[model samples]
Target: MNSTSKGDRLEDAFYHYLLDQQDRGELIFGAYPPENCRIYRKKAYYCREREADVEFDVVLELYRKGRDTPHLYVIFECKNHEASISEVYVNDFSSKIGRIFPHAVKGVMVVTSRLQAGAEKVARNARMGIVKYDEQGLEIIADRRGSCFEHSFVRSQIFRSANSAKSLKFSAYHDGEYFSSIDRFLGSLEPELVDGIRPENGGGSLPVPYLSIEQIKAAAGKILKFADYESGAVDLVKVCQSLSIDLQFADRAVLDADGVAILGSANFGRKAIEINSHSRETRERFTIAHEIGHFCLNHERYLRSETIIERDLFVTREKDGSFNYERLEYQANAFSAELLLPDAVFLKKTAHFRRDLEMRDRGHGYIFVDDQPGNSATYDELLSRLSTHFEVSKQAIEVKLKKSKMLTDQRKRNEASPISRVFAGLISSRKS
Candidate 1:
């Protein structure tokens, strides 16, 4: 392969491999806990010596325990071709990582090709670890004090290859299937963390602002009007980009979806919102919108303030059975609903609701035309059609309808309180 292609593949391989490691309970480095680190790819860091910036293949920021504060920095540089890693390149890379990061930094060199005769020695002297990628997976050739370099180098410590090498005791994953191993690994890790830490009761916690039905509708209205979405649907990817939120798809085994917003220095680079590639197209879009909601609503700042947020998971619940993240989750859910199912578009699309006399109840009688007769059947059909038209799940459409008062029942759906009614009316007038 060409140099550019090989370099790109190596970067991708290491970034993904490290993410799986983080997902698993494996220690990323001595100080960088698996659960507390954030990984960035192709990130540029400014070098004091050269007065110019140099980009690393991957930069992993390890956060302090129980806080969002970043504690340590680790950088990885990858080479794919057989070109030998020279001592000069190792020194230069080490210098850049050290100069760029204010905290203690560890430099890692990962290469598909073998290191030169003296390269490992040079890297080790510089406190850098060298990893060589092979058909069997990754092998760490140079040991360093700060990292789990020795553990990763051994045959037992290597990531397992999909075809074979499954017998290795410490191997958490199959080599080819890097992402699939994440869920199994994460499930085990969560119990350990939860057992060690007490659940936050949330009494003194700041209440997450509620996104009322009309407020969410207004948010959606603003987006559609700004984007000029006279059409039924909006290009969410484009919208996210316009808002400076990075939307990405990652094939993850453990997580259906997740995202993060970087609050650190810009030199470290912009953060991204990741959707699960394994999810269905509709699900992917919804997840992206959900994460976008988190970003727009400043949910990450709240999450990072107290404790670390796990992938595809929330923090432990309060004693009263409310989640520490319940309000944040609700806000994001509301945002996603409004963004995907604008009141104008959603109402227009489902305007032709046919009366289902089969139910024999007035309130529950409405069902979309061509939908089946029974509640489950009819709702399913409505969900399917709305999901298709809006490119969201039936559940999402249902939430928007019920919240906006379009779908209602006396018992299941509460009447909007006076305060809520006033808030909704105010939001509607402002939007108009």
Candidate 2:
């Protein structure tokens, strides 16, 4: 697309994104209800100082209780460029907004890429907000009935103030706190504008309940019962149908993430989960189940825009030993595991396989498998059997086996071979 068209697309996408947030009663820019908030595109406001109409890319007007006219205006300027935005653009926007609305107005510069050096400083000096609207690696397979595409704001960054760090990896920030999504950061600002609209604990970290494996498994079991699921492999599509969630597969080029869950809103009609169509069947199944876990756990209250990346699916702890979004990812993964492979059914199948294979435990309270050539065949056989029956990947089956304490891997033990032992003795002798 041409540069102008690209810019228009970005502006249109952002406009709808704001509208969706308003429909969901989660729009934080105005802190007003949907009925009281009005959004317009390419709107022109007459400036008394300039003696002409000043056009803005997008505008959001907020009305107070029982008021006829809007009491506050939020002006948005969108820029789509291949290069970073410079201080010149920021200064011009700052000047325009300043001359037009002296007070009770907020100017936000929305760009498609990063800001140039010193641009942030200029924006901060102007008391303006910066939002990097990135749609990298996003492909729209289907639109919302061929009108507006179902885009996600999770990849975008919203800086209420330009004083924060300019890291593309983490974009949402307000008052030194980092948020995972734009909705989260916006919701935290002016939380009192609407009662009980802000997230609990009043920060970026989502308050994910601490759930044990048993608890997660029990929850998954209940969901299975709810779906009347009695089969070898869980049919996640049917579960979504029962729950009234829309499930779709789109051609996603993004490698870092496999799925995205756009929390249901009135504008969007219903909750939707989109999986990367290019992923393997097993991976797709896992992604669907993971999203279902989020829905079943009532994470919708806190999750406005969620992109399920590989790290979010597996990593449970941060480097500093704290759990933020990591905790939620962990819970979802545990739930997915149990939902795919129920304890009773899995254990019974395992026992049958063990009896048929005459596999003996190696005194580790479970069957031990290692890289040893003798055990390789048996290990592969067991994994293949379970993977085929469960319709999940062998790697997933192996992890499930280890977690269940039904198997042990001695591959690390092989590193301490006789040659290593001899070397260790030699080193000790030399020290002596």
Candidate 3:
């Protein structure tokens, strides 16, 4: 599409996003109720200094009850650019909003990409908020009545400055503070709202204890027994039903995420899991099982909001090869692996497939994987059979095998050469 079309699309998306928040009673601006909040697109305001009407991409007007005039005005300047937005855009937006509405007005510069060097400083100096809004990143994984976990998560990601705009679902920055969603940004504008908002259960600041493989297996065993599951593949749908958790699917971009687990709480009565619709049935099944794992492990105590499980969350190691036991994501992943592939059933299936494929080696104690000029085909066949039987991804099956110590990966060993090990040690030392 053309640049103008793209810009317009972004404006529309943002406008609707605000409208949705307003409808949900989340767009709080200085105690203004949802009915008193007015959102407009392509709104024009008269500028006395310029003696002409200045147009805005999107506008939010908050009025008191029974009053016609709005007490607060929020102007959004949308910039949909392929490159990073420069300080010039922020300066221009600040100038226009300053000239048009001098009092009780807030201006926000929203872009599709990151800000150029010095752009954020210019925005902060001008007392204007900056929002990096990628349409693909607008998916909602989790939310709570008054939780700040999402805000904390977004702030951590923003401070890292490692993830691109597409990697973040939503982020807002104002006066050195980061917000996770637009509603939170709006609420921050008012001191009263800021004081009123409290983090639910300390806002996911507590560390999750590391769960051993045996503990995860026990949890999965109870779930399987509860579902009366004695089958090849664990039926996630039946399991969710038995637990009274709702399962849903949505057609979203793959970059958005794999799935989200919304845990039941006093504020939010029902538990639900939303999986991104995908063509790969195995992938979808794995996502479902992963969310179910969260529920079975009672992660709601730590995760107070909706927990978005991305592909990267499945990784349990840091770059230096240290385990991240503080994150519930690792625990959930372990539970998912056990729930999908039970020990007894998985071991029996693996042995049967290995025998059927004649993967036995007198010299090696375990099956070798990705070994060239050897039994690579046999290992692949074993993975395929196990993956098919469990209705999970081959990668998942491979991880399970390594965890079970039933296979040896040559590729992993090759990657961990002497030089790499030295570098990894140096990196770990530096971190320490």
lDDT of 2 by residue, 1-432 (tens): 898897799889889877866776656534466788799999998999879999999998878879898777878898887666889998888889888888877787877666765886787666566666544322211111121110122222332234321122224333333343344445444455634444322332333456666677789999998889876788888888888888887764553211233211110124777776534687777778888887777665444435565445434322233334545556666677788888788888888887777788768556778778778788778878888888887777776676677777777643433212322221222100
Give me candidate 1's TM-score against the actual structure.
Answer: 0.39
Q: How many clashes in each candidate?
A: 1, 0, 1
In Å, residue 393's CA in model 3 sits off its true spot by: 5.4
lDDT of 1 at 288: 63
The count of residue-pair clashes in candidate 3 stands at 1
Per-residue error (Å), model 2, residue 141: 26
State the lDDT of candidate 3 residue by residue for 67-99, as single tens digits: 899888988999887666788888888888988
Tens digit of per-residue lDDT, candidate 1, span 367-400:
3222234554665566577777777655556655
Q: Pick the candidate with the highest lDDT.
A: 3
Q: Candidate 3 — worst ten consecutive residues by lDDT sum?
A: 258-267
Q: Which residue segments of model 1 deviate by more than 4 Å?
A: 1-213, 252-271, 303-323, 352-383, 398-432
Give each model's whole-structure lDDT: 0.49, 0.62, 0.65
Error of 3 at 221 (Å): 3.3
* Whole-model alpha-carbon lDDT for candidate 1: 0.49
Model 2 stretches astray by more than 4 angstroms: 21-37, 46-53, 62-71, 81-83, 99-104, 132-206, 252-269, 317-323, 362-365, 412-432
